[model samples]
Target: MSFPGVRRCHAHRRAPLHAGHRRRTFGGRAGLVLAFALALALGVGGTAAYSALYGSIPTAEAQDRVVVRGGVVRLGTHVYLHANGSHGAIGITRVALVKKCHLRVYLDRQPGDRVVAAVAEEDEAMARLGVQAGISGGIDVVDVRLYRAGRRVCANDRIFGGRSNLWISVTTLARTPRKPATPAPAQPTVPAAPAPPTSSVEPAAAPG
Candidate 1:
């Protein structure tokens, strides 16, 4: 007994209720799944970026030597003393000298590894007060050199030239060791068959 317009209006209202129910059931789950996936991706990406930027920093002891006037003097140095491992950066934090003199510091890397150098001041104070020289990227060997104002000086090699006591301190960031490999499972051992009973009778004297 309802009019045609009223029936149509009732149908339209019921359609919206069914649609809303579907949205509530499926839409929320879909949204949650999408959010979780996004979060996981972001977390993984962040960790990778951090690893790439800063691989690992290694612990090492500092070494020093005296600088004297003579031929060119080269100091062999390393960030990690135990092994020639990978390093991201090397820095000379402080340098102590007995007297003020013109000095130059250089950082040399391996042939294949990335090479980077930190600029040092050209003034003479760099030798006495020390200058910060840092380089980034993987390096195997680092060569350090100390120069007098104009002449190459060898530490402890000459006795007649000006000598300056030098002690240099450095800081570095190096790569860490990889995860240990899992050990293989032990194999089960099989017992050897009992040796055939030794014939103590000597074959009964061969059928005597």
Candidate 2:
């Protein structure tokens, strides 16, 4: 009843089945691990990307003057105004002005003034408007100019003329504070020696 060749064939057939089971188990575990890793990567990446982009947008307040350079939005720059908590749950609100290089400014939610974007909270604003198109819609001022050595320059003139990325300051309707000129480096001063006291008597009348 014991035929060596037949027994060997049966053993060989069973060997493959056992090996197949192990392979399937390992493959299933590997697939699950791979999927989990991929999901984690995507989640972490999305959060970090969102945070980075959000940080780039500037924050300002009513009557607060902020420098606006080319921010996340290339059309111009986006500034989020601090919102009042009383405004219920909160929402990302925006008012776009199509004007370019016209020196537009908005503060305290005034009427009839063109604005870039005003938000309630940074998260709300960025989450909502971060990816929107045609964000800038306009330039803030006239000719771009930079400061030169030995020149008298105004704040607007300096912003336009300087090499800085931010050139616009949005403030309340009231006159905004001018950018203070950089004071020249102070130089050391030497005190002059007091003049020698002279005799009050006629001793000063040398001759006779």
Candidate 3:
């Protein structure tokens, strides 16, 4: 019966919450989502960068080098040959990127059929662009390098003489020319004594 008050809508009422608990809950969930998004973004960005770097994949040829283990490479033994008639050696690209990072290769060419280079046979596009085994223009395309216990091999000075970066050293391994030693100088000769006839004449003049 007293003065009546207007009824309030349920929607207008503030819902109950466990003090700061709701804030913490919301914060935790939001943090998780943000973290996931960040990770995804980083992954995507990384993939994009990689694609851009080696994306311009060339139209590969049917004949290419085979990759073995640990990024070792080898080319067609018959395609790129040495000047001396030796079969072309397998090429080795230290860490060539294939269609994906799924293949492996060993450095040295083993006594068997296998791809020893890091680059895949499917993506051996470099070959089409004049890449091959042997020392082409003073670069070892198919190098025979040496390595340390925990270091990658240097691609220079590995060939018989001056390694080829993308090709073999067609220049055969000739013996380095050794210089001949010169002989010692001869001793000087002594001069002969003066004529005895002059001595006799001079002696007579002195007595007079």
Whole-model lDDT values for every prediction: 0.34, 0.33, 0.33
Estimated TM-score for each candidate? 0.24, 0.20, 0.15
Q: What's the lDDT for residue 190 in model 1? A: 97
Ranking by TM-score: 1, 2, 3
Query: Least lDDT summed over 10 consecutive residues: which range in candidate 1?
Result: 61-70
For residues 116-202, could you state the per-residue lDDT of candidate 2 as single tens digits?
Answer: 443211122222333211112223321221223434222232232222122222222212433568999999798999999987765
| Prediction 2 TM-score vs. true | 0.20
Q: What number of clashing residue pairs does each candidate have, in the order they appear?
A: 2, 8, 36
Model 1: per-residue Cα lDDT at residue 28? 72
- In Å, residue 14's CA in model 1 sits off its true spot by 63
Ten-residue segment with the worst summed lDDT in candidate 3?
Answer: 169-178
lDDT string for model 1 (1-208, tens) is: 6686565444444445565466445357686566556656777454444433444312221112111111122222211111124312233222212233223333332233332222222223335534222322223323333455545443322321232233322232222332357899999999999998876654455554
TM-score of 3: 0.15
Off by over 4 Å in 3: 1-84, 89-146, 158-208
Candidate 2: residue pairs that collide: 69-166, 75-136, 100-139, 101-139, 145-160, 145-161, 146-161, 146-162
* Residue 154 in candidate 3, Cα distance off native in Å: 1.8
RMSD in Å for all candidates: 20.4, 19.9, 20.8
